[model samples]
Target: MNFTPLHRALGLPPCPLTDEILSDAVTSGVTETDDLDWKSELPPIKGLSQTDVPKDIAAMANSGGGMIVYGVEEHGKAATGRSDAGEFTEGHERAYRSVAVTAISPPVFGLEVHRLGTECRAVAVVIPASVDGPHLIYKNDFFGAPIRNDADTAWMKERQIEAMYRARFNERRRATEAVDSLFAEAAEGRDTVERAWLIAVAHPRVPGALTRLTRDEAREVFNDARTITLSFSKNTGIHPLDNVEYLNPRPGLRRWVAPNAATGDRSIWKESWVSVHHDGSVSLATAVGGHRMSSDGYWEGWQVEGRGVECAVADFMALIRAAARSLHLDEYDVRVGVEWSGEQPLSILTVDGSGFPYDGVSTPLRAFTSARSTVTASASDADFHRQTRELAEDCVNQGGITYLHVIEPLPEDEN
Candidate 1:
């Protein structure tokens, strides 16, 4: 439930945007900016397909994303009054999505459409700042990337387009590097014990304005996150924050660390921990496997339980969503990896009677394997589930477990 820039500008509450907020924005003399636009009305469905909806959306995305509010009359880019844009049905919302997809190139992801007011509804289209830009809008015979120029929409020139392409590539590289760095940091000191680690990291492209929190406040917010049951081949009830009992601040990293390191033998890598950063980033690691003892009690290679990986992914995604909400962030780039140290390859042990694994799935590992993807905190439950499953599948598949299905469809009511 990340609030839009417009919400911040208007000094409105961060959630449940309504007509009162819109009216307050107008009365307070709020005007259009590079990230905010106001519209008096919307065209008919046919006209909307060919009108400025796509252009405005593209411009906002290119200009670091913002909101386009309909039913707000404006003069000289200054808010004038609120007018009824008319009722927006589910079909109408779908029409807007369809137009954005068909009319814009490299369609923007994480677009949110909100209906405000009960009697006289106003529509708000929130576009996320995309790493996939520059997004183009096609005219009759030509296509041009639209950019927000001050308070208006403008076409991108040749040099601006080139710079955008460069920026896009750099963003991708940085995201990959960030994931690798975080994984390496978490994996440190693991060599002291024989264990397979599940490490996950969530990094925001444009970092949030999350201020530092006291250790007490940090503990309360994290512990309060809901523990939802993720249904896969089995039901794994996990909440990343709830897994750890002890919490302490790591001021050097500007984060709070919660680890269940064994008190008796600190060298043993039987630990589950989560690190929440001030920049709205989070890193979590949980040990799913330890020394596999033979019948004679001899140590064998690491054997990772397949169900542990599934449960870890479920907990990771849930915690990520909670962190995003707390920091008022929308989009994040996420990475997950499994690491173990040994000459022999790690084994993903299947349940004895589940029939989900075979002998050939376990192969020799060089060191570690990982997968990365992007997620929107405010996305629909189905999309969130799909993204989490895809990331988990990629990580497991790298270890030769191809048939792992980590996320199941949400219940009807939840959908």
Candidate 2:
């Protein structure tokens, strides 16, 4: 296989060679072969003295790169023949790790030792060039010394040591340039945020009716949809209704219940508050005379039709959805539902003319108003009341028109 400059410099294949190919090469006396510059065989010297291994390692690392095949013969012209000789076994792998740790200076970091097939007869030491410096093999006499010349390893001369250091500096400079180029490309918008949403019309348990929306489209839906029913609890926070809660009450009933109730009887009162808080921030408290009044327990001592409550809720949701779509958020993040203030009773509508058939009778919609003082602690009473009154008026005028224009029911296919 073709080898990269880095690989050849390390004295190994570009990629790992199979044990079979390695064994065959060794048996064929390929160890004696020379690359354009250096020999591929282990030096005749037995048990590389702790000092020499580092120098040889450094030279191989610094020189364009070559592999040092251990346990093989370096015959000049022909096969010098094989011997059991200083073979490296599994134990040698561990020993090499130690040798790298103690002997080499500035370290040969990515060194790998591979056993060559069956007899443990051959081994290869792969050492990558150091990006740091001309490695010094700590010898007894010479102290910090480099490999002399590329030929049979000897003590390094002063000039050779300087050249090696220069090469290292150049490698680091090149690496920095490469990194800068990468950063420049990234900054130019090669990478960006990707958003996705899974909008399922039918529940997850059912199949064939799921729809998926991409980021831009979902954002459009969120920004344009009218009347969003978001459930927000200062305690629990806003979230989609859980499946059990979503399924327990019939869609019409669920639509009617306060957005805060999870199941029967339980109310999320203390945990929440609601406000229009838009550019034209408005609120409707129980005192106003419609559905909001009926729900808030402040009726004018007269009964109102349940359809009024349904229509108001549907209208509110339609407005929220439109606002969310205009804001460009995904539908998955938007939800709509009735709100309950635990401060008062929550009511359910009955089929018969009898008012509030549920165990907890509902208050009048008028009692529930747009007044901020009733919903928020920090809001001024007068300001809250004014905002609520304005909001009630807007809901009646602007919100009512917008709802009629957008929320008409779709015609069903009879086929």
Candidate 3:
């Protein structure tokens, strides 16, 4: 019933380890050998029967957090090379889940099943150390209690069982203390929007450089600014076009801009946008809005992906109209134009006599694109901006679009 019961049930730390880290652990001898578990001597069976697997599971829980790499060669020490690695053999994963749910004494949760790779040669199951100690594995006639001893599993004795009970009590006390501490820390900063922004801004899987901006500068660009232009030098690693900027107007009112290009000088080019929100949300809304608006003749003809210049212009106009309807703004208030030939990834040029520019404003128009790019808006504004900029640059480099412009959020006072 807690906020994240699944995570709690699994007894894993708050952070989820990356696939690489998990993979490395499995490959580095986490898989059992004959010297370790009796199950290892039983050969790499297609699937666990009721009897063979329960003891291994109990032993693993009693031992410590470790992995069981099934379908792997015991002596070869290599993966199976099957196409579906971890996928259950017909009823394997299901059987594992079902047995874990019903057969284990107190129940174990948070068992993850995943495909290793293209080759279904191996399956790995991570078992957490049981605080309850020495679990009984009852499968038909075979009944035994087992405990973990360092790297090996051993049968449990009466004295060992009693000691395990005492240890279990101690573990419960420690677990309660740890959980309380974690809850307190999580509660300390309840800024969902800010957290979401950070998630948005952070680099995706690939490594890249980071640039920091002061809070004062962020406020200056976001507030009292008619238009904000972002430029970035090209790099192999993706970089956000605009740096991180925070816009926290009031309680429950915040917006983060991920990397994006507002405009460029040329009428023909491609552009992209990415948005991140505080609650671990991400979206990738490309130049579809611009394409929609331009196609409808709401703006001048400009080059866009997968469409001719005139068609692109018509689409861009249609996008502006759509954004107006969705964002509750007037088409007349929205300014549409293009920019190019600047140091920035995308240069934004607002239409003259089209009312105040919403190019850089953290209004619903920009927010819509951000939300479209990364559907989660519970992230911090700064992080979202950072991510959006990077995505914009990536789009430009990939020939998606050349110019970026605002198509909605027309000023309230515009004609």
- C-alpha lDDT score of every prediction, in listed order: 0.72, 0.35, 0.36
> TM-scores, in order shown?
0.84, 0.38, 0.35
Residue 252, candidate 3: Cα error in Å is 23
Ranking by TM-score: 1, 2, 3
lDDT of 2 by residue, 129-199 (tens): 34556766666666665442534555667897788788777865664444333223222321111110111
Residues 222-287, candidate 1, lDDT per residue (tens digit)?
554334323322454223344565355344368877766443443233467777788878888877
Q: If the candidates were sorted by their lDDT against the true structure, best first, what order would they fall in?
A: 1, 3, 2
Better of 2 and 3 by lDDT: 3
Q: Best-fitting candidate, measured by TM-score?
A: 1
lDDT, residue 15, candidate 1 = 73
> Which one wins on lDDT?
1
Reference-based lDDT, residue 155, model 1 = 92
Scored by lDDT, model 3 comes in at: 0.36
lDDT of 3 by residue, 147-230 (tens): 666545678888877888898888656644533332233233323221111111211111111222233433333332212221
